[model samples]
Target: MKRRILVVDDQRHMANVIKFNLEKEDFEVILSHDGGDAIKKAFDCCPDLILLDIILPKKDGFQVLKEIRKKTITPVIIVTSQEDEEHKVQGLDLGADDYITKPFGIKELVARVKANLRRLEYLNLPKKSNIIASEDLVIDISKYEVKKDGQVINLTLREFELLKFLALRSEKVFSREQLLEEVWGYEHYGDIRTVDVTIRRLREKVENQSGKYKHILTKRGVGYYFRRI
Candidate 1:
């Protein structure tokens, strides 16, 4: 089945350009010009992925992203004109799987889209050992779900993948570059800060509020590892 992608941008020309290119890659594309409509189409169309613009009428991409995350874990890639780090961090913090600054190459954008989809595909595949457990934390690999103390924890695709990758290799430290290559599938095309942001987000969701359970630990200057509690 051809994957469906929702492209939300206020600029009609830019939206059409993206749509034209994505369709050539054999993806069914849906276009939305504003954030309000973007949110509605997201739920209604049930897209395999989303390419969202930060600036929009009636609502903004961050608000739309927040609403979508409340009920779904669909991969969202922020397409922004801002070159500032603050906006990029904000998007990631709000559960965006990835982001691309404006005036980007069509090829790069397509590559990122495919990479995000590939991660989703990997998550859906059957595993010989479908569960990874440590203390009260349980990661259901097959179902792509995580729970702590028997209560479900909401995780974005990136956060879940990072957690699973480190947990599967418990006690093994991996550098930010290695993790960007392995988890984000970006051997040469990502910021190191992305890993730190994702790790912080993952820790917030999986670790205990009282700071007793520290499944993911940083090794000072080395990197991060899962210290099975």
Candidate 2:
């Protein structure tokens, strides 16, 4: 089955350009010109991924992303002209899987899209053990579910992958660059902030709020690793 993608941008030219390239990559592309329409189509079609823009008619990208995060965990990559650090942080903090500035190369955009989809595919695969348990936290590989103390925890696709990767290799330290390559499959050296944000998110979901016990630990001046406890 071809993976479907929602291309949400107000500019017709930009939308068409993205749609054309994605179709070449064998993806089923759907386009929405406004944030409201994008959200509607997103739920209606439930695309495998979304390429969102910041500026829109009914709502901005942040608003649309907020609403989407409220309902689904679908992978979203913000493709916008907004190059400010604040915008990037805001988008990622709101559960966006990835962020790409405008004037991005088609190869880079497609690479990010494929990387996110690949993570989703990996998460959907059957596992040898089917479930990974560490203390009170449980990760069901077969079902792509995570629960802490019997309570379901919502994690974006990337966050789930990061946590699962670390937990499966409990106690083994991996540098941010190594994680980017292993977990994200980034061929080129990209911003380490991506890993930082994901790690922060994983901690938020899987760690105790009281700081009583930590599942993911940072090695000062080194990298990160997961402990089984």
Candidate 1 structure lDDT: 0.93
Q: Which segments of candidate 1 are over 4 A away from where they belong? A: 211-213
lDDT of 2 by residue, 73-121 (tens): 9999987797678888788888998889988999999999998898888
For candidate 2, the TM-score is: 0.94
Report the poorest 10 consecutive residues by lDDT, candidate 2.
122-131
lDDT of 2: 0.88
The top-ranked prediction according to TM-score is: 1
- Residue 77 error, candidate 2, Å: 0.6
The stretch of ten residues in a row with the least summed lDDT in candidate 1 is 205-214
Q: State the C-alpha lDDT per candidate.
A: 0.93, 0.88
lDDT of 1 by residue, 1-229 (tens): 9999999999999999999999999999999999999999999999999999999999999999999999899999999999999999999999999999999999999999999999988877777767889998999887888999999999999999999899999999999999999999977668788898999888888887786557999898999999877
> Which candidate has the highest lDDT of all?
1
